[model samples]
Target chain A: MARQKMGGFNAGSMADIAFLLLIFFLVTTTMDTDSGISRKLPPMPEKDQEKSNDKIKERNVFVVLINKNNQLLVEGEPMDVRLLKDKAKEFIDNPANNPKLPEKKITDIDGKYFGHTYFVSKGVISLQNDRGTSYGTYIQVQNELAAAYNELRNGLAMRTFGEKYKELSESKQKLIKKVFPQRISEAEPKNVGGGK
Target chain B: MSKFRTKKDKGTPPISTASLPDIVFMLLFFFMVSTTMRQQDLKIRVHVPAASEIQKLEKKSLVSYIYVGSPLQQYQKIFGTEPRIQLNDAFATTNDIRDYITSEREARDEKEVPYMTTSLKVDEYTKMGVVTDIKQALRKCNALKINYSTRMLSSE
Candidate 1:
């Protein structure tokens, strides 16, 4: 037999094969940017302590309850979610600036030290949800509440710093945060199966 | 002068496709580097909700995922159809969260420990009870930075 020969395999088809696979992945995979409703969670409870109502005055409290039936109860009255942001803003700004409202204007001395002391810490948003509340309604309410705070901060940031809230310097951002702190105190979930 | 110029090889050699495979290979390697294959075989069904205000979790490594959804048909025999929380690969319960977070924190780069966040991949139809429990667990551990993993609503 003649000396054995080692033959080379043609590599020209390699690019065509790779292109086919590339096309497959290009069509099949979805390059999605993950996003969400960002909110700061409350600290853990030390114990099963009953929440005291005396600390936060009635005017400063914006109570929002979402029940199993997907209905919203603001303070004590039933309300549509579309109006939540405005109502929250009104309560926070208290545009009425009623003396009974717990909001306090910044004193010149306080204003000098702190750039934007719009409202005091008494402004609390207590969100309570049922165990059965669907995540959709829960998130929608959370988004609206967060939006309320964001709008407040943005408005003040603009007036005080002449910049949007997110665009402000770090120190300025801290000052803004002190004024419009997000006090969304989430109570323990209550009633789990109405999960529609 | 034209006759003396020796006809300048008009054929032009087919644009030298010798580098075609090399270019395609380069693209293939790029996609290979950038693409992350399914991190794990999802044993559960997760349909995250959509919202108007959204923010991307900055670093994938700094965030630990908590998947909450019902088991798939294959896992139904073991985990049942009820909505459950998953940590890494195994089907876990609310109680497992603390230890899981700790271990995951320990497994990361030492300096990155402080920036750890819990990304809750919760299904839209799921009840708030489980998500709340997980949140509370995260809070108790002081792993409070949370990313409620959500998709953007197609509308502005």
Candidate 2:
């Protein structure tokens, strides 16, 4: 057998292949993932309500809690996951319990509320979760909260105008949605307090 | 010369036909074993409030965020780089939030028409009142979507 002379090691070829593989993986991967629950947040307030101190103080508020163990607490007491929707509805409707009708209002040329502005006010939804809970559990809670709000909002629209929420007149629905509190504030667990 | 000077090997040393395949295989195997798969990464940890009926949002940007923590009440700040305007200050008397949103909208670029997608990242121990106050502020933005950020559960 003839002895064969070995050539120089081809470092460049190995380098090229490695680089190509690295690029392939980088491009193929998906960069973003769902943080958890997806929700359609309510719009910001309109002009009329902008100056009413009275309306701000007396508005309805809903409270939700998730303990370190991932257990739920509505208001102050522990609650079953099943009660989430009903509880949300109950809280949302608390505002409408008031007897007074929405006040009358006059607007400027830009449709901005000039005088006293009236809106069907939906109260705020307050959420608080413990530090130790998992993200999945948190998302679960959020979904429930939104569902409760939607149910309450749609129910009000149907009862008040005798029409489905989507089919109702835009102006009328807008009025209804504004008063309906779609805002959610995540409270600190320390202040969640004792159950009602 | 002793038996014809041992036949000298000619041409290029037997081209490493197997070397390329072996190198490629080793490279592929390394990546397959060593590459870490990306997963959901949440900036803040959360234990979401549970509900029976769950629905996904149509648009991701529209969802609002509210973060809650014990000491967070005193902090009164937004996470990351976004500015912190206290919830109480924003929603204090009347609808001050409405004013903030309007100003924000005006300052936003006209071309993008960025309909301010909003959320509040609250601390876990935040007071319900403060949350309410913040929510009150968000109501002023009139954003179409609202979502709280949370981490994913491990399969274990």
Candidate 3:
């Protein structure tokens, strides 16, 4: 055999192919964003508003409890969800109705009872899954609460303009939304077990 | 002695690579046109649990909700004490979840500034994969600043 010429194999094209693949995947893979109910958090209460002297004294606080069966208990009363929305709307639309308000404002209102400084706490849902409550039932209760919040917000929106909610002017509608935040924020972590 | 030359170059052969760039361009166009553009996928279905003691959130006009979950199945499965659709079962449909989220973002972004934030309330039992799906979808839609709702009382 004639003296063999030892030339290394050219890998330039292989590098080019690899580079092309890198670009391909980079272009093909798409990133996703958080997909959940769009909720705006209430701004921090003013420093003065947070004065400890005010003490968030829990009074007439609406205690709505959701159980593993998705049943709703408003202040220990088993109320229909539709009725709950109307009741909640009445309280939120006019805080004056919150019974927890100072006795003066509570009495000032035409009725003896009125809504108070309502602080719909994040954990207020209080989902108590019984020993055998399936995860599915728990989810249903969650959905219903979400719907109620939406309904309450929508109803308040309607009340603001005394018209169908969808027909309200954009600004007026927005004003209502700012007040409700769709009333759906992030769900608090489950308290897990307890009936108190 | 005169060195033997291979066949004297016939009239300079026309360079064929002048069109090489055009071929590359055509190939690029073909790939772009034929390749299915991968849509950003959400990792999970996030169904926010609702609260009875729900505070009315203000400035809701500036917020948007994205439902990330198994796609809406036409049929409902009555499995347990309460009626709840199964989440992310292999057969559950999820095609619209992404599109719905994308459209909501597009619609809201058009009317409001980009300052709007998204709050995610995923069911505790939802799989991590489903949550990823939701996040990927949100990123594609250009939504940011996800908030998780939690109870101060529970940990206490």
- Candidate 2 residue-wise lDDT, B39-111, digit = tens: 3233433334433443333344333333443322334353433222333223122255566456555766665
Per-model lDDT: 0.79, 0.52, 0.45
Q: Using alpha carbons, what is the TM-score of model 3?
A: 0.35
For candidate 1, the per-residue lDDT at B1 reads: 84
Off by over 4 Å in 1: A1-30, A47-54, A105-121, A192-196, B1-16, B22-26, B29-37
Residue-wise C-alpha lDDT for candidate 2, range A1-196, written one tens digit per residue: 2334565565657756766786686655444333534455445546677665554332355668777566887777889876887777666654446533222123221233212344444467777765455444566667667677667767767777777776888776776566564678754445333421
A1-196 per-residue lDDT for model 3 (tens digits): 2345555455446545555754685588433223322333334345567456743334423456555445667656887655755555444444464455312122121121123433332212233334323333344444455555666656665655567555778866655454454433332324334311
lDDT of 2: 0.52
Q: Please tell me what DockQ candidate 2 reaches.
A: 0.17
Residue B110 error for model 3, in Å?
Answer: 18
Model 2 segments more than 4 A misplaced = A1-60, A95-122, A160-162, A167-170, A189-196, B1-110, B116-156
Leading candidate by TM-score? 1
Best by lDDT: 1
A best-first ranking of the candidates according to their lDDT comes to: 1, 2, 3
Model 1, span B24-126: residue lDDT tens: 8777777766654454656789999877767777887687888999998999998788898888889998899999999988899889987888888898888
lDDT of 3 at A4: 50
